[model samples]
Target: MRNFLVSSLILGSSLVALNTNAAGTDSTTFQVKITVNESCKFTNAQDVNFDAIDRSTGKQNTATGQLDITCTLGTPYKIALNGNGKMSNASNSGSTIAYNLFQDAQYSQAWDKSNTLANTGSGNSQALTVYAKLTGENNVEAGNYLDTVTATVTY
Candidate 1:
């Protein structure tokens, strides 16, 4: 009985030692990081079309279109239009018309490569209206006229 009690006490102590070892604490670190990059995109932009333009009216023909742009917040950008004023007819090579684009409703702020239009980004979609005026002084042959003006944004 004495030997058995001693063996039992030794086993109980071993079990207690194992339990203490199992309750031991371990520690590590967890980390997180984030990064944001500058970016911009053109959401939408329709062609500025003046359908069936009158060549002999001698009055300014006007049209308006919109361009949607989205970019990172607080970004500064300048928008410019680049293309010749001449709108050549696809069917009739000799027929052509002249036109100009403005940034303001007053037709004063011309949107051209030389004079870039400025605006700030709101981190959301922004609608930019383009005011276009066709010069009525053109005396070219009558036909379907078309022209493509590239809208460029410089940051």
Candidate 2:
């Protein structure tokens, strides 16, 4: 009877060892990623104020204004201006004035959609100067005139 009991205990211990050795391990792998979208924005608000005008001069008067722009590094961009030269006076609905915007002080490159001035970003703020001139004789009238143009940045 003792021998049989010992033999049974040995068999149970061997079975437990076999089951422990039979157990296995496993692992899994996954992927990670991110997408960085390009972005840009105007850093400042600007207005091309052509102060008081002398309509009697019969000559073009000029004014200057600047805006700051910031964009992602290595981003290519162009600034375009769109507006009609005919500016209307608030007090006199019938009164209007003509003007033009340019990309240089010489008033050569018209800031029109067709021009599409091109530039690149260096991860820093850049100043863009807008030149404006009231061409031809200020033949509109002797009243205050105003015009607004939208400055668009394309990347």
Provide backbone clash counts, one per model.
0, 0
- Model 1 Cα lDDT, one tens digit per residue, 67-124: 9999789888988889887788889866777898999999998988988889888999
- Measured with C-alpha atoms, the lDDT of residue 100 in candidate 2 is 80
lDDT of 1 at 72: 85
* Residue 47, candidate 1: C-alpha displacement in angstroms: 1.2
- As a TM-score, model 2 comes out at 0.73
lDDT of 1: 0.84
Query: What's the lDDT for residue 69 in model 1?
Result: 93
Error of 2 at 15 (Å): 26
